[model samples]
Target chain A: MRMDLDKQLNGSVQKAFLLLEAFTLDKPEWGVSELARSLGANKSTIYRLLATLEKLGVLQQNRRSEKYRLGLKLFELGHRVSIHQAVVHCTHPVLEEVARAIAETVHLAILEGTHIRYLDKVESPQGLKISTEIGSLRPAHCTGLGKMLLACADSEQQQAVLDATPLFAQTANTIVSAAALRRELAEIRERSFALDREEYEIGLICVAVPIFNQQGDLVAGLSASGPANRFREEALPHYVSILKRGAEKIREGIGNFQL
Target chain B: MRMDLDKQLNGSVQKAFLLLEAFTLDKPEWGVSELARSLGANKSTIYRLLATLEKLGVLQQNRRSEKYRLGLKLFELGHRVSIHQAVVHCTHPVLEEVARAIAETVHLAILEGTHIRYLDKVESPQGLKISTEIGSLRPAHCTGLGKMLLACADSEQQQAVLDATPLFAQTANTIVSAAALRRELAEIRERSFALDREEYEIGLICVAVPIFNQQGDLVAGLSASGPANRFREEALPHYVSILKRGAEKIREGIGNFQL
Candidate 1:
């Protein structure tokens, strides 16, 4: 991928992105020398990149520590992205209602490359909560929302993603083989939904349904999640039904949304 | 500033930012040729930059039109930035309460360079609203929140910003003169609050108080905004008191916040 992109992408532009990618929540701020060491780049080049990012207001340097961190411009642009997605805006109230009705966390996710990108979530009103951040991504092989998207994806898309993805087991119940994943996806497609019984995380269970556009194309997944003990086998039917209804609502309203 | 930054900032890096800035809500997507023409750059340079951005997932190219738009990577980073800003997390509930109590929009903003960057907002339950994006920046000379921040800025910091700022009037009531702005700041410092009586926009009035950290250092501005007719001089005392109390709450809780 790097070689392919290098043929088209300017070296400097690529370096700028490399710099931006270095800042994460766990390691949000970085001194120039430390960052250069981590990225295996020259101090001068890293310094130049940091200065340019600062000038663009994409990165801000702490006055006291002189360590660089992500800036407010990205936050502003991100806010625009959330509203512009339209699907998020259209389905939020529906998600809230669904979460309340199910007494479980409700999540809206879109298929991004080979992963599920959580676009929005409504926390369970109950004491036991399953929470995840917006913009967080999870592998498409182990989660209910991931399976829901993969089930609806074209064969080529599925093959391309599965070929690159390592099916690392997240839990004892995780389907770690491509053949098994394919079989599960086929079942999901037939049922128009997917379920994960402690696959992505221990003591957690999730059920998801595909959200479609007016043209009947899969756009996203709507999921209900709760603790494994509370979300018993008997509750599956109800959870699936409610998730499908919520997904249907999103599909009906998201036809006009560009995202 | 550009000249100073140019000594360390790479030209390619600056051009990359220009590309990102081109995508606004009104014109979110752009063809390569159109963007090149708009940015006054050659086709190859613009194409390379677009390719780099697309590869980084910071921008996505539409498959049909081949127009490039901001992508989910930026949205992801932006989400992280919002949560990382401790000030936002600490003050959100207070802003919500303030909005409800005043029956007007409430805003929390931080001084960023010579501008005020809105960190959070709670909309009025009433039909009328003064809505703004979380990361949006506005000149510090006109807005009530901006003036509140500027009133407490150190002398050197104030002079540096005022020297560079043009103070272009947004409305007939805007104080465009440097001397007049200085006088207003002095009055705001004495009163421990600031007011914008349709200075930024016609028919809109805002009252703002400075939020201080436990150490008594000014950190942010909390403001209540409503239509000019509704937020008249007669209501000033009530608005100021509410805002001050809200600001005090934030100050007490925000000492531990790193932002």
Candidate 2:
């Protein structure tokens, strides 16, 4: 069945992507044989694909290890994606401003399927107090940015996402139940802000606000995160105001853009 | 020749990359017919390729234009590159610190082929005074980062680069002769710093220093750029000190890593 699989499909490009998908942040490098075993493909086919990718510079082999990793060419092309040039370019400066004002790590993220993917970040001056990486994903039910984005989405989309995602709890503070999350989303929509009180990580806390484009469609979520001890209840209003200002600046800069 | 080309090559993956290569920043959007014409491929083949890529989230079609553009999946994969995770991760904060201290735009770049590719940047608080984008390439003969990197590379590599690259002038101050460039690079090596002197653009100037790993191998070049009017000769020592400190910080963090 697996042998017919390669022949049955209009293959080449699809096979290439499947190979690339095997490389991830958790396991960035792979030997040809390991990759072949993992993908359920023949070794010679995998070797040829790896050679082609390395030749194109989409992947590179470490001379010492002979293991392949994603290369700089993808980095170049990734930055060329129009959405990056059009959206992240404008929002990055604003993220910086918010990070400076809050003296905490700031993030711009959007919900993709059931996860929130960080699009950009400006780390705190005091050092990287947060572990979030650009282009990395976190579960939607526990992050402040995720809640803010999910809260602003239309009911149908929210329901679809909720139905699709399992809503597993990461910490005691996470609102894992669909009914509880629905109430929190409703409250977030009314308040125009969202907060994560040690939900995703034990000592991390975040506050977020929705960013909207000209059509009033929610474009992304802007958030400032810091250690739980530093997150004072009195500072909530200040954080919300600062995030809202940054969001408004982004909205003004990005014209009628969507994710 | 073109028809036979596909059969001659063990194609699929190569064809997909050739197709992806056409979606550059200068022309991010492409219609099926135009892409087919540009790449000298059959329309049906191009159409099928685009369809496959779109299905795999490698490309997205603009609703209004029906043209294809590189998608977020590429962005997601690009950021996972170990170079970005290992190198830029340490250098970006340092770039930000240098920009804050100097009150000018700062860059971290390295030689890729015969060109200098920007790896990270922090814009001046005054605004984006430098137009350099992260992951973008610029001629290695005109900018301060370029000269600094070239001056530090091995003699054989330097000669290979000089022999390969055409020393075309960008601004009137650009050194168009190989002999003149060699002299400048020698001076840069002797002085331990490099200056752009408005070589790349009429009104811009930059100062740069090389970063070395624990092994003392040249890693990257760190530079701060600003308008010529804002650049003062009296502040040269201060700028150099700041950039050197940032470069040292990067050097300590990267250990034995090379480009």
Top TM-score model = 2
Q: Candidate 1 on A1-259: residue-level lDDT in tens?
A: 1323366568888777777777876788899999988987788888888888888888888999998889887887876663434777678768988998899999989887788999888888788977577787998888999999989988977896679645888999999878888899999999988999899999998899988888887778899988988867887888888887888888788874545
The docking category that best describes candidate 2 is medium
What does candidate 2 score on TM? Answer: 0.88
Among all candidates shown, the one with the greatest lDDT? 2
Candidate 1 — which residues are off by over 4 angstroms?
A1-5, A82-85, A90-105, A122-131, A162-166, A190-192, A213-215, A229-255, B1-5, B82-85, B100-103, B125-131, B164-166, B230-255
Instruction: Please give, for residues A46-146, the per-residue lDDT of candidate 2 as tens digits.
Output: 88888888877899999999999998888887888776788888888889899989999999988877779888888898865798778778987899988
Interface C-alpha RMSD per candidate, 1 decimal? 2.1, 2.1
What is the lDDT of every predicted structure here? 0.82, 0.86
Q: In candidate 1 chain A, where is summed lDDT lowest over 10 consecutive residues?
A: A1-10
Error of 2 at A71 (Å): 0.7
Q: Which stretches of candidate 2 lie over 4 Å from their true place?
A: A1-10, A100-104, A124-129, A165-177, A197-204, A226-235, B1-10, B101-103, B125-128, B171-173, B201-204, B227-238
lDDT (C-alpha) at residue A33 in model 2: 92
Candidate 2 chain B minimal-lDDT segment of 10 residues: B1-10
Fraction of true contacts retained by every candidate, in order, equals: 0.76, 0.65
